[model samples]
Structure formats: structure tokens, C-alpha cells
Target: MRAIQITEFGGPEVLQVSDVPEPVAGDGQVLIKVDRAGINYADTHQVENSYLSKTELPLIPGGEVVGHTEDGRRVVALVGSGGYAEQAVAHAPYAWDVPEGVTDGQALALVLQGTTAWHLLKTSTHLQPGESVLVHAGAGGVGSLAVQLAKLWGAGRVIATASTEEKRKQVLDLGADAAIDGTPEGLKDRILEANGGKPVDIVLEMVGGRTFDESFAALGRFGRLVTFGAASRQSAAPIDSSRLMKGSKTIAGFWLADCFANPQLLGGPLTELFDLTAGGKLRPIVGGEYALSDVASAHEDLRARRTVGKLLLDPTR
Candidate 1:
């Protein structure tokens, strides 16, 4: 089996395609012949050892995979690691059958990114009907899905922030009521303006530092902001408890890993997401597909913000 291996923690440069032994299944796991591997921004942090969890050395950097089991059942799975390979092991409980009408890319999208978006709104924020939502990085994998889900769940308005004009248009096409420049300059004002000169009810914030600060500031009374990632790798100032109390604001943090302990967290929403894709109600945007050997280039593109939507790696290549 060939896999992307990193012996040291650094950047994309550390990733290398190497012929590695096939991973064997454990008691509660199943062996999978990987067809596609999903590339996420978190994978970039994994390679750099900056993720929420620790990264062990000599690692194979992938957690989401779409593949076939030994019994020939096609499934999309969330693996602990080793997904960027010709073969990998998946926990049986974590793998879900791919519905007939869904493509591999769509199934891949539902694994880590889709579930994160689902939980962010349904779990972390407990989004209410007619509530306004602000989705940062609306052109990225999770952001793209978050935008659509928010609309489908009957949000009053969905305001997205993207880095470029083209991406902003894409966000709008995904059903955002408004799309604004993601640059820090005038972000708070732009968000307010897009929301009819009022603060948003909920914000899906990933970019840290000033972006987080501004998003927090733009929240209305009883507003909720869910922070999942710090793509900017910058830290925001500590929140003042007094300010939170004054506005009745809530700041919540979410990580997809936490959902693994409860099967319903990943399985239930994933089934819904798959059904939505199959029924033509939801669309998974695949930004680009790369050969397994080209994994490093994929990381570079994602980190550079040169790609939109979900990215995939064809392990067979």
C-alpha cells in the first residue's frame, strides 16, 4: 500500500508518498480499499502538529475516506488516521454505507466536514428558525455545506464571507442571502450591513484573531458564535466575562472528534446529509481531485486558499 507519510512535524513539505505495509483491521474495525480520501484544512494542521489533538511522528495524514469493504459494500468512513493510502482500517461503527445515488465525492464530503457543519448549527448553537447566520470561509469545504444547511433549516438569512469575488458569488449561489469580502477590514460593518443593519443571531467562526474578534462583536443579543478552527493560526484576545454577561452572548467550541464517542452524533446527521445529496436538495462542491502521490500539492493549494469546496485524493492513483 502507498500512503502519504510524514516523519517530522512541519508543513506540507514534510508529506511524502511512500510504499507502506497495509493496515490491518482490529477487533471492531474493518479493512477498506480506499478509493478517495478527503483533504481538510485540519490535515494541514495535522502535518504541522498544530491540531487540537497531538500528532504522532511517522504519521499517515488522513481521517476521512470513501472506499469498499472486504464484503464489497461501498462506504464512507471516519478513521483515526491512515486514510491517505491504498488501504486503511476503519472502525465498523464509524463507517456508513454510501447511498445509491450519491457520488464518492459527495459521500466523502459528509464524513468530517458535513458532520461538523451539521453539529455546529444543530448542536453547538441550537439554531432557531428565522435566525440569521454568519458563515466564515463560506467557499471552503465546511463553510460551503454550512451555508446550504443553514438555508435548508429555514434560517431567516445566511450571510457568508469569502476571500474573493468569485467565491462570494459561489456562496450566494449556495443560498446565502448576502456574500461579503472576508478581509478583516470593515468585516463587522459588512456583516451588519448584509444583515439589514442588525447583528447576526449565530456565527460559524473558524478564522481566529481579528476575524473572531469582529464576529464576536457583531453578534446580537442572545447571539451564539461557534468556533471550530483557527485557520489564520492567530489567537484572539481573551474574552471578558463581563462583556458576555452584558450582551447575553454565548461562545461555544466544537470539534468533530468529540462526536466519535456518540454514534448518533456522526451517523444520524451523516444519514440526513447523504439523503439530502441523493434527493438533489444538497450539493457537495468538489473543488479539485488529486492523485495520491500529489497529496502535498493538495495541502499547498488548500493552505493558500486557492481552492474552493471539498478536495479529494484518488488513492488508486
Candidate 2:
């Protein structure tokens, strides 16, 4: 089997393609002939040795995949790592059968972001109907889905932040009530204007550092903010307990990888997301596709923020 491996942590060039032995399915795992893999900022973190969890050397950094079983059943899963290869293994409990109407790319795109967005709204924030939500990186993988799911989950208003105008427009098309420029400067005011001079009820924030500060400041009383990712690779400033107490606001964090420790909470939301896609209520936008050997370029583009929507690796391409 051919796979991309990072013998050492560094940049895109470290992702080298090499021939390796095909992995066999374990007791409760299934060997999947990987067709597509999803690239995420977390993958970059692993490659750079900055992930929250310690990773072993000579690691395969991919986190999600959509592929086929021995009997040719189509499936998608959050296969922790080793997904950027021709074959990988997935725990049977977390692997889902791809339903009628979802493509490999679409299913792969949802493996992490979809499930994260689903839990961010339904579980973390306990989002209420008619509440407002502001999602950062509104055109990226998780942000795109978060914007739509916020609407479907009954948010009265869905506000999104994107880096470019075209990306902002895409977020609007995805059911966001409004889109704002995602610049660190004047971010809170822009969100305030987008919200008709009101703070929001729920915020799905990924960008860390100053962006996290602004997003927290833009919340209304009793507002809940879920910090999921730090794409900027910068640390957010410490929170002041007094500010949170004054507004009765709450701040929470989520990591999909951590949730894997408890497989019990995994399948139900993903099944619901697939059903939404099958019914045309949801769409996981695929912005870029790269060949297995071009994994380096995929990492470059994604790290440089040169793409919108979910990025996929076509192992057979």
C-alpha cells in the first residue's frame, strides 16, 4: 500500500509518499479501501507537532475518510489518522454506511466538521430556538456546516465571518442571515453591525488570539461561545472572570478527536447529517481535490488559506 507519511514534524515538504504494508482490520475494525480523505487544520497541527495530544513519530496525519469495505459497501468515518492513503482502518462503531444521495467527497467532508458543528449547537451551547449564532471561518469546512446547521437548528439569525468577499457570499448562500469581513481589526463592531447593533446568543468560534477576544466580547448576556479551533496558531489571551460574570456569559471548548474516547455519542448526529444531505437540506461544499501524491500541495493550499469549503484527497486520482 502507498501512503503519505511524515517522518518528522515540519511543513508541507515533510509529507512524503512511501510504500508501506497494508493494514489488516483488527477485532472490531474494518479495513477500508480509502477513496477520499479530508484535510483539516488539525492535520497541520499533527504535522507540526503542536496537536493537543502527543503523536508518535512517522505518523500519518489525516483525520477523516470516505471509502469502501471489502464487500463494496460505501462508508465514511473519522479514522483519527492514516486516512491519506490507499487504505486505512476504521472502528466499526464510528464507521457509517454512506446513504443514497451523499457522495464520497460530501461524506468525507462531514466526517469531522459536520459532527463537530452538530455537537457544538445541540450539546455544547444548548442552543435555543430563535437565538442568534455567529460562526467564524464561515466558508471553511466546519464554519460552512455550522452556519447551515445553526439555521436548521432553529437559530433566529445566523451571522458568519469570512476572509474574502466571495467566501462571505457563499456563506450567505448557505443560509446565513448576514456575512461580515473576518479581519481582526474592528471585528466586534462589524459583528455588532451585522446583528443590528445587538450581541449574539451563541458563537461558534475557531480562530484564536484576538479573534477569540472579539467573539467573546460580541456575546449578549447569557451568551454561550464554543471555542473549537485555533487556526491562527496563536494563543488566546487569558479570560477575565469578572467580564464573564458581569454578562453571565459562558465559554466552552470542543475537540472531535477527544470525543472519540466515547464512541457512544458519535453515530447518531452523523446519521442525521447524512439524512439531511440525502433530503437536500444540507450540502457539504467541496472546494478542492488533490491526488494522493499531491498531498503536500493540499497541505500548502490549506495552510495558506487559498481554498474555500472542505478539501479532499482523492487517493485514486
RMSD of each: 0.8, 1.1
* Model 1 per-residue lDDT tens digits across residues 1-317: 78998899998888888998888898999999999999999999999999999989899989989989999999999987898999989889998999999999989887888999999999999999999999999999999999999999999999999999999999999999999998887899999999999999999999999999999999999999999999999998899899899889999999989888988889999999998999999999999999988888999998889999989999878
State the lDDT at 193 in candidate 1. Answer: 97
Query: Candidate 2 on 13-89: residue-level lDDT in tens?
Result: 99988888898999999989988888887888889888888889888778788888998888887778899899999
Off by over 4 Å in 1: none
**Which pairs clash (backbone N, Cα, C closer than 3 Å) in model 1?**
none
The number of the candidate with the highest lDDT is 1
The local lDDT score (0 to 100) that residue 76 gets in candidate 2 is 88
Error of 2 at 108 (Å): 0.9
Model 2 lowest lDDT segment of ten = 257-266
**Candidate 2 local Cα displacement, residue 284, angstroms:** 1.1
Q: Cα RMSD for candidate 1?
A: 0.8
Tell me the TM-score of each prediction against the true structure: 0.99, 0.97
